[model samples]
Target: MGAAQDPNSPVVHLPAGRLRGATEGGVTVFRRVPYAAPPVGGLRWRPAQPRTGWSGTRDATADGPSAPQPYTEGGDPILGGHGSPPFDDDCLTLNLWTPSADDAGRPVLVWIHGGGFVSGSGSLPNYSGEAFARNGDLVVVSINYRIGPLGYLYFGADGAPGAEESGNFWLTDQVAALRWVHDHIAHFGGDPDRITVAGQSGGAVSIAALAGHPDAQGLFRRAILQSPPLGLHIPTPAEYLPRTGAYLRLAGARDVDGLRALSWPQLIEAAQGLFGETTRWGHWPTPFLPVRDGVTLHRHPARTLLYDAAADIDVMVGWTRDEATFGFALDEGYATATRDQVVERIAESFPDRAAEVYGAYEKERAGARPVDVLMDLISDELFRVPCVELAEARAELGRPVWAYEFDFPTPALQGRLAATHCLELPFVFGDFATWSHAPFLSGIDPEVRAGLGHAMHQAWIAFVRTGDPNHPDLPVWERYAAPSRTTLRFDAVTAAVEDPVGVSRRLHHRASP
Candidate 1:
């Protein structure tokens, strides 16, 4: 360890202007660096515009406002609430942490936070990038883009001026951020050529979507997707416009102009009302998400991969062992579900193959609780299967891709979380203590924490620097292919396993028709 500069003060220059940053633990961090102009007034629902130049040094040391969102915290034990970041329309800012400001060409990792494409910010404490700057000697970047109605709702078809062409504003915002990095990151000691864009959950979904964008080519050479919900069906506008109309009606708005006139809080309430009406449908209830509008997004990432889209880029993807436990840890009904109840719900979700789906899980985990079986089913349907499906698609295309499963169960919440969604964040970022306050990850064993953290962090660094995750200490992580279906299982001791838990996955395929 070494002495560091005062975290309250440091400065760097950018194409737009000079920025004041903060330094701590030998890593200097620049916060809230605007990558695009504020999407406000006439700019609302439009593609992100270029940031205006600043005259003098701009103070970027403080956290900027988060995009407007309805609150989602439900006071659950395992699921903490997050729609609470300071909100403002000017939320297209990015944060960065570098070991030094000199042009050392350190590998850069840009992070996109996950909040179901509705609520999340780059400035969350759990997303701190100091550890990467300090230990991996990499420049870490996180960004905020438009979200919720302002980011995803499609109203332009109804002749609303900015609504028609605004279906993919969020995706455009991401492209703008990447372009900013390519043009300016070198001045902050990062190698723009070696950038790797990474994210978990919805953010990972966004990365997958970006792979289909023509403009996103060459923005990054590598990608890392953690627990992307690949099977979540995205509804077309015709299928979803009723809810948009409901939101407008809820807000008592005659049109986009009237909708825009409402305050942020009012807009959030209207969106929340629509979510309550639609959440029962089991599709993603958020009003904002990527659309299949042939322009910004050409096709679904899985379909894109089938056609070799982004085949030249290297990808590393994985999911935690029990990804759905976090969602139900706080739901008494789900936590106490009976075998019949589980079967009935699964039937409802996959009406075409309800019995076959239930039979597959019941047969795989005989004598296990119906609730437990259902949990595994939900996890596979939402994350694990998608992880394998994406990897398989990439492998079939002859693209370089590696897949893994994070199996380190948490010691918190009486060990009930069981390696649930987002449990791998601390290990991946190598910042357990910084996230000690997180409801889902608190109280982790120090010994298990350190070993897993070091391994995951190093693997990410190795992948970013050499385009391969293999190193002297890591187990031989083989490139994923269908014939062998070789996969890495990361736990207290990491190892490569052949088709770990393929029974349910195989059953899922058989049942899908």
Candidate 2:
């Protein structure tokens, strides 16, 4: 084999091909490296397969194509303030940021970007791995996977080929990417044994699923699930069975042969129109999502962890202070709801604990703005409660777990949105300068916030390197226990606090699904 050195830069050669990456701040970066063959055409709706090995060098310059995403008017502002342009099916790719081309066996941090599972790419500027790689002396990776109906629809009918095994194809894509990392990251100077998987929102949910997946065992050593929710977008077999039938009927075929006869675009359009305006979940169709497939996922991720399914893995999980504030921002009516409106919405969203939830928040938030109180209630029920429940469950199972609550308010949105959802991304990735409209990063002293990012980033690296997060010079984080739960409070001055949101967490724990 020829020397792996780029000669022109610091990129190296892999068994599959040669890659040339850009040099920034003394680190060499490679982007959009394919790990599996595109799951298009006949392979559509099937599990991911390994990419055919290539000869000579392949350029790892620009980001790979992003999977098909719905067109939002402004698109994802966080993805460089513009919507993702149209792209093709070849989107299974990964990006790498490293200090050197030679194999140094450095700890690896693989990031899974979060966009509610419907949207997001690993190529976002905020997810850039340069700072974390250079500052922590670690190898950083970001990956892209299938999304929406194409990646998540379930077909369990007997006549359809592979339908019984196709419930979690998107998750299978993630596991395949990890397998690629295990077999190939060494060539990029990363230690596969020390691989740590981290993600937010839907990506975080995927991490939790991987933790419980039997096939995913040993693929990753540690995981960080930020703002993970328990029952987001989970489809039941009944929900999918009818949808599968509809697709078959629309294609004008009696069996699996007829279903496969329809074109990809035709199938996608039929699936998109499955859920009409009168449907329970409004505009969002419920055809495709991770289900209780006995093979890929035995049960709900939270239940799996609670029953000791993930007892051997190390985990850090938590939520933000104002997680639901974003929902209010998207629709102002949510912030200014009346008492009757709040009660009705609560009952509709959470019928089991509607009265108890209303009482708890009513007592705690007396005289507060209706919007603020509603935001807290929804945020807790949807995200915060689910997160703490996972920690409590893991602790019960004798697994090591650490929790946190990001409380610092953002200065960019004025005081309207406190430490809201996705606020932690810029801080974690050290991209405050780019978010000029962000209040927290713009108004606060950069020097003070700089240390918070450094400390949090280092803690992640420490957890990935070893199961324990006892880095020198940082606070000794205690494992979450029953009554006296200790959590890392990330703010201007980060410290450990006992039971940060005790009452709300307890109420939600008792009431959550």
Candidate 3:
């Protein structure tokens, strides 16, 4: 239904119904507009269906519930505040902030939040769309998809109808949201043809997978992958079934209905063991993530992108300098780790390439302790090398691939947390003060924040408008090419460097698992 009449409220008629939104800072924003029907009851574990049309204007002024998720245990502060908006099963909603609803043909940027596919919704304060709409004159849309076991766990037995359709339901939800944008975003003044799907970490991984999926083709013209874990491919049914079985046994569910009947607390309890906090690196013992179930998703996204899949779409990919610092901050022991401890951890994590991994990082990071070297190894393996490889692969296909490295460190915690994972988000969104009170951004200098934030926010706008991220405010950034590997390093002093951190790239190429 529609809200009470007010001059400040703006109304846009979506395909489903009329949506009344609030006008703030010269932009009209509609919060929590459903893109799909609630994925509960019979819809649970199945693909998201179209949101049934309504008779009146639905109240779009309030925030919506997020997918069910367990509490975040990491020491990173930014991760803690994500679950605050609300949580519910009927959570496949999207928020839009537009300059006007007058067929402006403004570029659309659809954001997918990062929580390793288990947590995070689009309504986080950090994801507020007002800045983008106010500053860039574009339509900014952020969406929420399924998370946790309800979104990723496969329960259908071999050849079972439920199991086949149940897998990749989260990806299905995202696709449904994109389809909704294709059909209805024009009403919100966004160009349906010029949509850019961008995400960080797991969200970036989702974009990578979407790039490979044939069904997702033509929905978006360009993609921006920020710190995607390229090496973390989707699991095969065989690899994931045993974990699913264990979850069933833990929950005492004898059948699929019994599994779906489990409550949120019960489901989280059954799946809690999957995420062990003891590991120094980010390794989920049982991740409820996308699987290569031969239906929704087929092959590894990074590999598929290499062979001309989504090659027609322009791409921009990059990662932060100290990507593993978040993992280390989560485990304090790593800060004071002994040299032997470091070697042992490396051997345990990468048994086949322990020597090569050690030699490569140690040679480049001389005078550093084994612990520091180990951190570098994990960082490169987890993020740095994978991002570079993705760019190289796409560049090899002769597509426009822009590579970057975010080297700007925050002045938080006595400078311990360097340019780590998730740090670039505030700058990209132009909301540094929003995260100033968070644990991860305690000592951020105002001047540094403004300078870097301006560069990043403008660059993203440039990317959305035209398929290129280059803007006059920044350096002459070049598209990625073999050997040359031109990359824009965003820092206190942004520079266009040629193949920054080549040592780690070579090591990853030599010792990849």
Candidate 4:
């Protein structure tokens, strides 16, 4: 955590300035490197501006602040929030890792952290690029963007004040980060042309949007979307416009200047309040999504996704075996949840098909608790079905797409967590220290962790290295298609299955009205 200069550190020169990075554990790590100008003052609520070059070598040895976000006391059990990096408006920075800053022509991997578009930073320890660099021999980059109201709050049809491009600063910041990597990654031994964008949850949703985005399509050649809340769909500015007053009221701000004058903590407090005030459970995951602003983004990426513009881009999409099973951690009522409660939950998301959905779920999880049924139902609706739909959309265009499911249910809490929402992160990053606080890995077997971790890690590396995720370690993985719906299942025994969840996928068809 020290910011002192290390004489032996690697210094990579870029368009912005010279960046000195810390080398450790056989990888060079660059922390808190700015990709865009600080979104502050008049720039607040506006699209990200390009970073200006510095006069001298910029220190990239220490991690800076995370994007301004709401405070979750004691932190998130699954994601871990307490004792995390502090927040600031100058949060649009990125971290990079390279085996050596040479002309290796290595493929690059860029990560977008997921926090439901509300919280999360690329500087998170689990997102460290060391494993990718040391193991895969690839240049890795993880980036940050504005989040919550600061990044996503929308103005009316009149547009934002003091800036030309209106809302979706969140999405704009991402575009700028990808552009930064695409432009200057070569100085860090990364092949800009071979970049792959990877994200999970809200980050995954961002990748989907970036695919069709005019500004972001050419930034990366491949994409990996894990557990995106695609079923909820992206909201239009019209939908966002209604929520604007809540923030203004919270900050007592009539204009962008008045709002920006407030501290980040105050703004994030307002952001949390706005989301908590009226947003329902179904919309909770996307409380602050990048709006379908016709300017930067032409169409919604995951909801009824049609990526005709970026069809040629390779995609790898998947979810946890029990994606929604993690809902219990968020809400304890599921412990005593009843069939009535399950029906009510279904009605919120699908009112027209509540009875049909409930019946289908009941049949799927026969003799299971109502809470379990609700978890499975919400999991499919919120995460799995959308993942399938996204892959299906990519495949229908006659393009290459691979799919897989992470099924290593955590032995934590007597295995109540199961294979939950973010369980794959530790496995993917293969960093136990970063995930030390993670409740799911509290007492899990190291061997189990290492086995699945290596399998998933190699698969990701293979996908980034070559457009195909097929590696000899796993089975002959096939592209996801109709009927077979081949999906690689990650578990104690890594194997590829033909439509393993075919029954679950088909039951909805029978139940849909």
Each model's lDDT comes to: 0.79, 0.72, 0.80, 0.80
- Give the candidate order by descending TM-score: 4, 3, 1, 2
- Report the number of backbone clashes for model 2: 8
| TM-score list, all predictions | 0.93, 0.87, 0.94, 0.94
Descending-lDDT candidate ranking: 4, 3, 1, 2
- Tell me which of candidates 2 and 4 scores higher on TM-score: 4
RMSD of 3: 2.6
Clashing pairs in 3: 1-57, 156-163
Q: Model 4 segments beyond 4 Å from truth? A: 1-4, 159-165, 281-285, 303-305, 349-353, 510-513
Where does model 1 exceed 4 Å of error?
Answer: 1-9, 72-76, 79-84, 159-162, 281-287, 349-353, 510-513
**Residues 1-513, model 1: lDDT tens digits:** 211244446778776778878777788888888999999887777788998989887877777898888665553465465545579888999999999988799999999888877777788777888988888899999998888888877664664644654377888999999999888899889998999999999899888888778888788989999888877766665655666677788888877888778777887788787777667522234555567666676566545544455778889989888888876754676667776777777876677887777777777666767677777887887788878877877787688999999998877788778888888887898887666657777776678778888889889888888889887778898999878888888898899998775875776673220
Clash pairs for candidate 2: 18-57, 18-58, 410-440, 411-439, 411-440, 412-438, 412-439, 412-440
Of the two candidates 1 and 3, the one with more favorable TM-score, higher being better, is 3
Residues 1-513, candidate 4: write the lDDT tens digits.
Answer: 443376777888887778888887889888889989998887888789988899888888888898887766767666556336488999999998999999988999999998877877888777888888999999999998988888888884564465444567888999999999998888989898999999998899888878877777678899898888877656677776667766788778886667878888788777767766656543344556677778866566673235466767888989998887665645775677778877888887667988787887788766877778777877887778767776766676677889999888887877788889888998888677877876777777888788888888888999999999887778899999877788999998888888866666665552211
lDDT of 3 by residue, 419-502 (tens): 888889988999765665467766777788789999999999899889888888899999999879999999999989999968
Worst 10 residues of 2 by lDDT: 277-286
Per-residue alpha-carbon lDDT of candidate 2 for residues 307-327, written as tens digits (9 for 90 to 100): 455667788887898887764
Off by over 4 Å in 2: 1-6, 72-83, 158-164, 242-288, 306-309, 348-356, 433-448, 470-474, 509-513
Model 3, 70: alpha-carbon shift in Å? Answer: 1.8
